[model samples]
Target: MRTYRYKVQTSSYGLFLGITAEAIQLNAPPTSRNQVSDRVWLDTGRVHHAYSGRKLALNGQEVTWLHLGLREYTESIELGAPGSYVLIIIHALEVVDADYAEAALAPALAKWTEAEFGLAPRSGRINRDSTTGELTFSWDERPQ
Candidate 1:
């Protein structure tokens, strides 16, 4: 198993997203619309901040963010028989309670992972560290 880890830190908090796979592949096609299209779910915590619209585009292998007031969002494209991907988004806030944010986002993240990539958690765990103010999520590939 290979583990891929990525971390992004802001002044207020940090975000971590990872994925483990038997093999990882990247496909960079010439056409703009080479990516697999899927709907992403967002949990804005507050009703007012809910994601109103989604516009997904592929710049090489990266998926752009949906309009949800997020400072930054990203994803990786995996190429294979059961191709899949992972996404990470961070909000720019002056002061955020990491614990609360993690608790609120975990289930939403899980649901998004399953829906977007068609993969379920095979091992490991997802969590957010209050002290470090980092939200962490991970998933493994399904068995053949």
Candidate 2:
């Protein structure tokens, strides 16, 4: 098992984390629209979650469609606004899915943004279209 870690810093002040993996088959369907917020609904691998330190472990071969649902707080760093953020670190082992893991994990982060904030915002430096008045929110920001 290779030491693998993925880190993400989000400006969402109060966040709830939930995870899903392809390896574990769900015996029953999710009880609610946002099971991620309901920590009790989450079980390891099946409906994986971390209430305290936010860490998950699973066999590499069993996972393919791993996704995370990050429940967002009311406050958000608007398109061009500045704010503080929280950093989330995910640790995993590389045994059989090293190649696929990289591609699959990248999109999960973006999905988190959509799940937390609506489609109007995206991850990256802030950019706006002057004529259209469109806003491109920043996914990562450096505090000075």
Candidate 3:
């Protein structure tokens, strides 16, 4: 198996999460209004979270506002696990194309890593998928 890593660029602070999963499974954001989108405010104290669209999901289940795919890939990517790891499971409805992905997903990942995870952000590369224009968000993080 091959491993790929990318840096994340975030507007938030501190944390960086690298998505090095086996593959990225980008899917369309869910429709129904049963859940809500989260609007967050990171600060000196506890961060504030607001929701109004779809709740975040890790693999295929609902998560708090943390919203990460690779984290849910297993229970522990904590310090010493095996395989690559994915970082986020974001809303991609507005991501009409790759350029949109650049603007939307890229920054989202960075900011998520910074504020939510509290890690410095950087760029990351995905293991190429078989199809083109296919949307997916999943990864593997093997210790090196």
Residue runs of model 2 more than 4 Å from their true location after superposition? 1-81, 89-100, 121-144
Task: Quantify all predictions' global Cα lDDT against the true fold.
Answer: 0.31, 0.32, 0.29
Model 3 deviation from the true structure expressed as Cα RMSD, one decimal place: 14.3
* RMSD vs true structure, all candidates: 12.7, 16.2, 14.3
- The order by descending lDDT is 2, 1, 3
Query: For model 1, what is the error of residue 128's alpha carbon versus the real structure, in angstroms, after optimal superposition?
Result: 1.0
Q: 114 in model 3: Cα distance from truth in Å? A: 3.3
lDDT (Cα, tens digit) per residue for candidate 3, span 15-88 = 22232112222233223222222212111111111122333233222222223322332233222223323223
Question: Residue 113 CA error for candidate 3 (Å)?
Answer: 2.8
lDDT of 1 by residue, 50-96 (tens): 13323322222122221211111223223222343322232221112
Error at 54, model 3, angstroms: 17
Candidate 2 residue-wise lDDT, 1-144, digit = tens: 012233333452112223322211233434432233322122233222333443446444222223232323212412222232222223332223222233334334445444433444443433345677342333453243
Candidate 2 residue pairs in clash (backbone atoms < 3 Å): 23-62, 124-139
**TM-score for candidate 3, residues paired by index:** 0.25
